[model samples]
Target: MSDTESRLGMPSGAGAWDERSERWLAEGAAGTAGRAGEAASGAEVPRAVPRRGAVDPVKALMHRHRELCERAVDPLEIAAGLEAHGVTDRTAARFRHRDVFSLAEEMFARVPRDGDSQGFPSASPSASASASVGREWGWALWALLPGALCAAAVAGLRLTEGQTRLLVAAAGVLAVGLGLRLALARGPLSRHGAPSAARPATGVWIGWLLGYAALGDGLLRTAATGGPDTLPTGAPDGPWPLATAPLLALALSCAPAAWSARLLAGRARRRLTSSRGLEEFASAVRPLLLGSFALYLGALAALLALCAAVLDEPAGYAPTLALGALLLLARLLTAHGFTHAPAVVLTACASGEAIALAGVFAGRLPGCGFLSVPAEELLDAWGAGSVPALICAAGALTLLIHAGRTLTRASAHAHPTPSP
Candidate 1:
């Protein structure tokens, strides 16, 4: 096996993740077709029609390469896998230098001329008639989209301010509906297993946006301290949202939120590449994160509702927002791609939170003022917002290290081998 395979093992017995990850980047993950764009669309190879009754020459050629991807870390390993997969000794000798991506490009270029070869039924007369009708309907819809949008905007401009706002909102809804229709029209990306990386991650900050917009103005209004003893950097009282910096910070920090959740919550699975242990562990922990997040949200909502019922004003502004930030930051941490056991990473997160909370209490760390709304003129306790800030600090450090390692490997792949 390749020397890099050993790096898949961690400094300790984190299992063989080091070897797994090394294999992942070296030639892409096993049993994974690269992204659709990278596969058929991106390749610059010649597209040639297959001969009648002929084998898919390209697919036949790639069979051994895919088989070798399982346990082949080095030339010797690949040769062994190739032989075991029924490649003649002469054939194996000729393929010793073949790169995986090059082989895939060739496979992409091969177009099976018959429907049976590509596993599609031949078009019947009725099916052909329906396809033509569908084509006409598509062109008609395409022609109507822009005109409808212009009419909506024109109608909105002639309405009263309040009515205009409603009209604009309706138009926005229509636009989203149109976008969804177009995306669905594109069909699925691929037929077989798409590698984990092939899946696109959406941002989950929309929920945060809705929550912040609904309560933000009140949250900031309640947090303003008139006391002279207040720190110079503390949030000043105003109708406008508190410090704009936190908004930007949260936006960037939570950009990866959805992606992380997908990884932790078992949304993405590396079927061919990752070990069974890693997969099972990920599958198990995902539910814990999901259930934890759900329970936290339910409790937070109920607490806020209770506060509203008891107090006349925005009562849960401080603790509710603080805890909400903590929940999101914690979810983000779970997606941090720990190489070893999930337990070790979870431990680090818990310890880091404790240490960070201590630092904040001692005035060693800056506060997340935007999220830390105050119940009174002053807060005597370190607000729970410190948990998220501290968690973010730790996650940022680890992510930086991961990025550096990735860059180093890319440099090696570009030139020679990287340093271990």
Candidate 2:
């Protein structure tokens, strides 16, 4: 018998049953035709009854989709496969089911839990489980590499001076970039099945946000102080007001982001498997989502505190923390396949920062004093960083609400592939 037949517990002579059913159907049709002709000819004939029991309606469907049902990891996969093949609730009713999900559940149950038939050799269950656990731990450690690289870079930046500082900074940036690439390649942040279109946009927005944090705030500070009419092309003559602390904090956050995402995805997958319906799944996964978010925030706060202490910067900056939270939430959403909302939120925050800068610059104009009042007052009260903090905090809150709704859905975690 073929692998499919063995896996599905079908007899080697199943084809004979198909032939017999076909013959019965053909004979039944012919009998009906004959009875119609006799009645039309005024010679009444008694109807013939079937000798065998009625064939199950779903049996044919199950045989036709045997491979799909057997290969599915869960009923959801079978349901998705069926829907992709144009099966709907109406189509499911023909097979005596209320919907495609119910039909898929029945099909999944009918298949025997034999060895893996997905063209791979099966291992002992305990061995496979142990290997999976090992890989998870390995990836978790790998995820910390980016943060370590960034921390090393921060230390190098603090130790160097003059032109040598520039070289060390350049090398540090390169090292951190490579570390980020390696860390995200196979860990929880790996981008296996993320939407292709949203990726470029996401990268653009992330760069904008980070770049603004590093240099844009200085420009706004310069403008607010009425120091220059033109934008700064090179380093300022005085002490570099670079807010590297926030940037470093964000970099160090990469590991926490990955861990939180893994925690949420792992727990959500378990919930998906155990829950009987959408409501149950949502209820079980919601707490996991909130807990993961809180865990990430706590980790980010610790990283921020560490960065601030090492760099001798203020640690109470709400904007820095808010930006970190916003970034983590955005990355989490994009990794899970909900990309549009994050992209949009990031864009809005970036625009708000840009507008704040523009308002500062415009306030220097002859008749646009009112345009800069808000920016100047905010700067005077809380410094230029407050602008980004407010903007990012709003964006983060928006994403938190959006995540609460989208991430709780079963469809959001449908594929559950790693993302970068």
Best by TM-score: 2
Give TM per candidate. 0.25, 0.74
- For residues 162-201, write the lDDT of model 2, one tens digit per residue: 7887788789878977777676666676643222334676
Stretches of candidate 1 exceeding 4 Å from the true structure = 1-94, 102-116, 123-205, 210-222, 225-420
**Cα lDDT of all candidates, in order?**
0.35, 0.72
Deviation from native of the Cα of residue 337 in model 1, angstroms: 16
Clashing pairs in 1: 7-18, 8-17, 8-18, 8-19, 9-18
Best by lDDT: 2
> In model 2, what lDDT does residue 209 have?
84
